[model samples]
Target: MSFTEPMGRQRADDYRSAMVSSDPLMDVAAGLDAEVAQYFLVSARCGCFMQAARSLNVRPTQLRKHLALLEEQLQRTLFRFQGSALTLSRDGQLFHAQLIAMAHERKLPVIEQPLIRLAVAQSILHDILGRDLVALLRRNASVRLEIISLDSDLSLQAVSADVVVWLASTESPLPGPSFAVSEPERLAPLEYLPHIAKRYSRVTARPVSLDDLADFLLVQWQHERPVESFRPWHDIVDQRLAGVVQLHSYELMLEMIRCSACIGLLPGYMGRFDRGLIALPGLFDQSMQRQVWMAVKRESAGCEQTRMIVDLIRNTFHERREWFDT
Candidate 1:
């Protein structure tokens, strides 16, 4: 259409006619929406109507309208609500994952600056002070931090992590080449609690000490250590208890603790860097401290920004060490 042309009724009618029946635009739009709703639902982690709505970043009212329209088109309820809780019907789950897989390559977040690949032990991923360092570097747009967690320093699998955070002994005969970043604290044992599922509430807890714990359970990240000699917390086996109950994930260990199923070691103070988990009087001694390292690959040897972040970790922990917590 020419700019000189008036958008009169006749022109509007012509455009509408062109855009419909004989035109393919509506079909294209409809197709695009099919992909959009699914992507929004997956990224949002919303299984039902509300979940899809929340993930789409649209208001519930607007999402409801879209969902109603979608359900009307499909002629089925995607979810069933019972007692204020929303549950996905079969179709909702099928469509949910599809959205995520479709959007994976199309929408990975990107930043323009050179990124600092930071490999950290998953356990210390509690409240990283990295964002401050990241923002500081962003001034010159120098470095963006890529955070990955590995259980062991041996598996520095991150092809890109110029720097890493590791927990080690002040006494280990390990390489002193890596610089220290944060001081470590002794990991003390928490009482084992029951961790049965709600339906299966019949569970029990047994007390075991460092000597009698050889038969107890220990949580270790298999990716970082093998089953027999797993070292989730600085080779807890070296201290050698009687028997250990083994677990793999830190998150899982937390879940186990929540369920009151197993006893595990927890960091005493200034952990979580936010709330801080504190040890009780006889539970674990807080006077003891451990050393954390911010080691760099020989390749990034002289990078000032890398050194700066290590300093940030050290200073953050040192300055806030008083958070002696619960």
Candidate 2:
């Protein structure tokens, strides 16, 4: 393909002028093969003909022939061999710089957006992080963020995510260096409080005490796999209570509490988002609180995008600390 085909005639003339007059070899800029120039650029960037060939989806021999044609056209040696390593020659470096500048001037695609994958606990994602993540996407177009809702018992090491947000009890906190995770940051405390829908409260007498919950249907969120350290409703309600319903999804549990005459435990912060939910008074205590931790994989901790996301989450939690307070 000819690089000038998509560019306006004046822009193509400007591109040629930018490359010409600077170097004797660039004098032939008017006759440069765009495809051959691209092949040379990729080969220079990869520093290996085979790697560049794979990136361009072309055979190694074909990539070599294309670069050879570019060198013949420009009358300059574009690459040199040092031991087993392939490197751009002095002439090649100059051409590479000019090509980069031309691509920028023409507004051509040069780099791919960095992708950062975030794995979050189901409840935290729905109740808190989802909005912040959406705002981040709108604010930054250079980065690609993937939000994965974790609904099962998958460990941090098992999931292929750059960042992880999960609920951790005091007894079984986030794993250490062995899990290939950086030092975890405690984002916020989740104070679980009993809540009943406003409509449900009007239909039935508000629970005055924890024991009063036994009279109403209880909707509880149960993990797909048993987590011994996390028991949100440990002594608050009996699982053997007659009308108790267990569910694996936090969303379903919230919906059940809102639509039926069922009472369930939710984080204190949830009351701010769902005004329809009324927290039962005098039922919450310090024992019901759990910690929310955020950590990045050790390998991804240095990424700027990952750090940016970490800061956004940290700031959101800090700003909403009051909502999580009992």
Candidate 3:
């Protein structure tokens, strides 16, 4: 049987992490007693067997036989007919819920591709830009890209990404030389209190330190640029903040910043692109800037596909060097 959804649970060790796990739909269908489950589907939808049989294009006798088979498997009667109306027993409601959930489980979507084995976040494949990048990467090439969904930073570092884009600074990955875009390490501290959202427009003519960022409400990415936990500032964020709201994307954060939701730490390129995000002087120093980097195992980095991807991403972001270097 062909089913579309990736199986098990996101990042689970069981059937999900396994490169291929039979066919997810087939696996799920194999678990249930088909005759009974189908009966439950029709019975739960239509009250009477005769009406359901007509609606489903099956004979009432046939439908009843399916139900009988299911009842035998579960050793429980789903419904009992009283003089005229069909009534669902307590067992029936519970079984009905399971059947619906099973139906939903059957709907997981997974598309098949040939050879490329990629270990990355699901969001990468789903993001607007990410989608474009993927389409570009998969064009008639010598290799196939296997797309895998990674759930956390540990998974990212533990496994391997031919080219990595992350916010955190760490010892260069296996093959050494790495470059960071909009380097997080170089933010120039503002000498004067930075003009944050309009609400903070009058924050203080006096300067506020970066360490004081916690004082203002901050709207941040629910998924931050993956940073290694060892970085001091990674955890420097105010632990006691009353105004941290996590959002789904950077675009939304910029929107919130425009509304003065709070002061935001935005990328130089992204900040300049969004008119709403104007950087004030105090949050970052003149020398402060975040860096984007690309690193890969020596052998993997030599692959033409991976090299092209690295060059495309690096050159694309490299054009924005003035934002950070300036």
Candidate 4:
């Protein structure tokens, strides 16, 4: 079969019966299908059916079949044939320009290098930063990311990681050249508290009174840094609240809050995003704002891959600061 052939009346009739029963022009007018357009673009680039087919790793006849489908959809001739040479029609030239413009509209991938090992606090991993982190990691096709979730103390010990994100009190900072961003450590009540006060409820919304905390169970994770260093927690410790309980894992602490087991202490980032958790703004103390730091080992600090990952974490948080508000 020749590469360019007239559409037989019988084939056109069959196509009409099988697919385009009514308003074929409407379907064609919507847009040229991507697969059909891609084939046409390849044909335009190669300037011949056989060469385009070879470049696309398809048979010459198969390429012609695709081009035929495109022509049928457009109801216009895209190519003109003279002996063995091929030339683009006016419609084809316009389409080729459109496809090139569409290609330019796409965003180029950002980071392109090797594997990056990143360790972050487990709570941070599952909370606000999780979705954005995953999306950023995927933008770079060549990156192979190994993400480890740990406590800040353990994360610091994970020297094997290329970069580490940890939450620390201003009193006890992470060791290294650190990009420290302060976010308040917030407390959550077992029930929802609106930001505005109502006469029916004693709980004041935005600046919740510290006295209201006495009514809820106080939950804490054993050996968590912010709790030990923050002064309000020390006050809570002094009182030895009647309902205080300690859990080993942050996940368990969150589940306890969901079940009304206790009022969970949450970092500002997680508290803002969790619909299930209500912020007890009364419990937020300015002196207790914890610093979230992204750090690397002194030796790896200058490595290009490590710097790229660290910069991404810092810049993304700076741009979306509202998500981490107390």
Among these predictions, the greatest TM-score belongs to 2
Residue lDDT tens for model 1, 130-246? 555554444432255677775654554423466766555444423323444333333221121112223212224232233333444544334434322123243554565544445
Q: 2 or 4, which is superior by TM-score?
A: 2
True-vs-predicted CA distance for residue 48, candidate 4, Å: 27
On a 0 to 1 TM-score scale, where does candidate 2 land against the true structure? Answer: 0.63
Better of 1 and 4 by lDDT: 4
- Candidate number that wins on TM-score, 3 or 4: 4
- Better model by lDDT: candidate 1 vs candidate 3: 3
* Candidate 4 C-alpha lDDT tens digits along 1-326: 23234547774454344333444433453366666666787788767777676555566788899889878777878798767778777556544545554556654234345677787767667774588777664443335678888765754564467676666655445452243333322221111122211222344432356676666567776646344445566466448648777888877777777665366566645445665555555454444555565656556667777777777777667666776544
What's the TM-score of each model vs. the native?
0.40, 0.63, 0.41, 0.50
lDDT of 2 at 294: 80
TM-score (C-alpha) between model 4 and the true structure = 0.50
Residues 1-326, candidate 2: write the lDDT tens digits.
Answer: 12223556675565566566666655554346677767877788778787777666577899898788778877888789888888766567657657777677777765675799888888888888889887766544446778888765555446778888887665455542235777777887776677888987774689886667778898777762344433546544455547888887788899999998788877777779899998875764445666788888889998987899899888888878888765
> Best to worst by lDDT, what's the order?
2, 4, 3, 1
Number of backbone collisions per candidate, in order?
27, 0, 34, 1
* Best-to-worst ranking by TM-score: 2, 4, 3, 1
Better of 1 and 3 by TM-score: 3
Kindly indicate the candidate among 2 and 3 with the higher lDDT. Answer: 2
Model 4, position 299, has a per-residue lDDT of 60
Q: Local distance difference test, per candidate?
A: 0.47, 0.73, 0.50, 0.59
RMSD of each: 14.4, 13.2, 17.3, 14.0
Q: Predicted candidate 4: what Cα RMSD to the true structure?
A: 14.0
In model 1, state the lDDT of residue 205.
Answer: 27
Candidate of highest lDDT: 2
